[model samples]
Target: MSDQTTQRHPNILFILADNLGYGELGVYGGGPLRGAPTPHIDGLAAEGLRLTNMNMEPQCTPSRSSMLTGRHAIRSGTYAVPLGGVPEGLTQWEITLPKLLSDAGYATALYGKWHLGRDDGRLPNDQGFDEWYGIPRTTHETTWLTSPGYAPELVRPQHIMEGRKGEPSRELQVYDMQERRVIDAEITRRTVAFMEERARGHQPFYLFTSLTQPHFPTLPHPRFAGSTGKGDWADMLAEMDHNVGEMLAAIDRLGLRENTIVIFTSDNGAEFIKPWEGWAGPWRGAYFTALEGGLRVPFILRWPGQVPPGLTSDELVHGVDLFTTLATIAGVAIPQDRPIDGVNQCDLFQGTSAKSGRDGLLVWVDNRLQAVKWRNFKAHFYQQDTMMSPPEKLPVPFIIDLYTNPREEEGKRASGWVLEPMLKMVQAFEASLVEHPAIPMGTPDPYEPPRRCP
Candidate 1:
């Protein structure tokens, strides 16, 4: 971060969580009910914006890929979670948010959880970041690295790599479930160091600090363990909140509070794993389904003096919009060379307009477009009640008013009310594909040196 008087671009601090519920945050409706009171995360909503209708894809890799590139995961070759992260990710040609920022003279780094392929050409640093230190894939895949009592220790280790430009991505440690307990804190400390380094330098920084918690194997750090009476998941949320407060405080300490844009969001909705599943609040279904509970998430943005405080909007915003929005805020240009799915919602964020000015967002499960939502009505092409289960197809997409069936109990067949708008959205999506032509499926590249993957 730099002095406002001399700074050209605002620093971007994007915080993301794994399997965090929409109702898990105080603003979204979790907090004490979920056994974790998130004052710090709630504070972001209080002082900034909380998007009630913000949407993400139903799974992690797709949601994350869409967020970064502002392109559908199918187009980016990450529509589904890979077998230990294969088939490469996003391709070497795709332009990312960090890549844009880095090109525009801002320092870019990513700390924690990069599931976007770990091969030589697809890691965080390879994409656009200047420095990257984090897990290369999902947390569940590393359960074996955990201790016997804590998490199932693996025969093979998941490397926590430290990557920088011109140097090889170095393996710093093999993270276990025990490491997951305090990994957020470790990431926070590293992020604060990044901020400190940038504060003394001329270049502003963008740190995408993704936390690996509230996901499976949610082992909370010692202090936060059982802080929430509910269970390990609740305790993990509380710990994450504390780490968030620490990160925010560090920005203020560096006098970069007003010059930075802090965004807190999740990759997707709550996990569906029982005995460790998250509460989706009043909604039905969790990750890997076409339910609102799986796609909708908490999106909070705080930028002092730039974005107004205490503003809550239920306007339509999608995960893919991050790329264009961040680029606009940073005074950078969106890649005119490609068709980016993100819309520049700078006006909505600045509170200049009440509407998000978005047409709609598609609902996908892996490569299949399961549903399409426009306004309050949604048309479901497939009926899926659980993750990894076969979806039932309908003769016509089942259209439902999300308000009436918040739990996704059932839906009426499409009529003019739902069919008309849904058709438009579907046609638009089809046109976009016809115009740009996507490289839909590709096989995984061979695993690189230093480590082997299944």
Candidate 2:
């Protein structure tokens, strides 16, 4: 067991950033935009594969739900980030990435943000993770709880919850700056420790190291503070890269490089709100919109012997596919009892194909449809100014030729051209509903209070 060389399926480590934009890494031209270079992250793209057409939902909760379950957020009842004491998150009907992998003898641990559910029945431990050590809500909770006139009950709900292999999950304390400032570093430390610990064991493992940096109140660790000289965003970005380097180094140190598969990506798109929030690459909108800037993000994967080095692919892969892809890699079948939106994308992982199994992606915010992307075309049926703003459904759908207008700055290019393909997409999506009916949006009723009263 100590050899680290006798493994069948490779160990997988999936790292997700909170509000990382597509343009913050060195490979994505963020080196010139942000202050410090993301050499460690960029080196990953150079060593493995950098996905140009990776698609996902535009918000954190939905995106994470889609990634964990091989299904759309609409099906899992976790369509958006619930706030203000709202009881919403992943329902028990859904199975998750860690649960599936754990069922097949793989040790699973979630070492960071677990925004899927809040209550006991809906949390990471209940969902499938073997151990959970991270925040239970969005990064905004800390700020919201600390704001003026904030309700006591509504504000201080989140904390550093820890779920170990033997003990039950419990709240450690109220999340504070003492924890928030070095949260990313702590996640890295735990992830490296887990990897080193597992290297001595016989069982292969799956670790989801979800870092909560670059979200709002972007605070860099003390060592990285002002080192970027760009701003809080720059400082945070550099700190995140340094943290990734530590975990990568641990894998190398334990001689787990060959059998380990490391993945780096963001929860959604970039944060485009603050001067220190960061840029969104060549796309429009950010974080919580239906545009490319919110959906299109960087996806990098490194596997020494399986995945080819220095390869780039422009295929259509969605975050929903993580469940199916890893299931295939682990020699386990995706759950056939339920409808799965993800496909076995290991072909693209191994450089065997230039295409993904998915031909289109659906953009859903809360319960309503916002956009539909088929092939090279993007069709928008809704719009929102910010995450807090209500999305307005348009009378006519706007179309964008993504190949020519990847930024989505142009308005309605050949609007009628989307009708046929959109109809086809709608038809296919509706067929899946026959078996697993789409769950209603999990937001509180209209009579219920808003998440935050302005």
Q: Give me candidate 1's TM-score against the actual structure.
A: 0.93
Candidate 1: worst 10 consecutive residues by lDDT? Answer: 445-454
What tens-digit string does per-residue lDDT give for candidate 1 at 53-104?
8889888888888989989887766898876533656677778988888888
TM-scores of all models? 0.93, 0.93
Superposition error at 405 for model 2 (Å): 1.7
What would the per-residue lDDT of candidate 2 be over residues 1-454, giving only the tens digit for each residue?
3344336668999999887888778898787577778889998888898997888888899999999998998877678777635667877667787887888778889988988877676778877888888988867677766678888665455688987654567999778766788888888988998887788775689999999988877888888888878777778878998999998889889988888899999989888656546677777778788878788888999999889999998888899988899888877767877778888898888999877787888888777788888888888888675666788888888788888887676463755866787878777888878645776556432222223334
Candidate 1 residue pairs that clash: 87-444, 144-153, 144-154, 145-154, 146-177
**Candidate 1, which segments miss by more than 4 Å at Cα?**
1-6, 84-86, 145-155, 411-414, 443-454
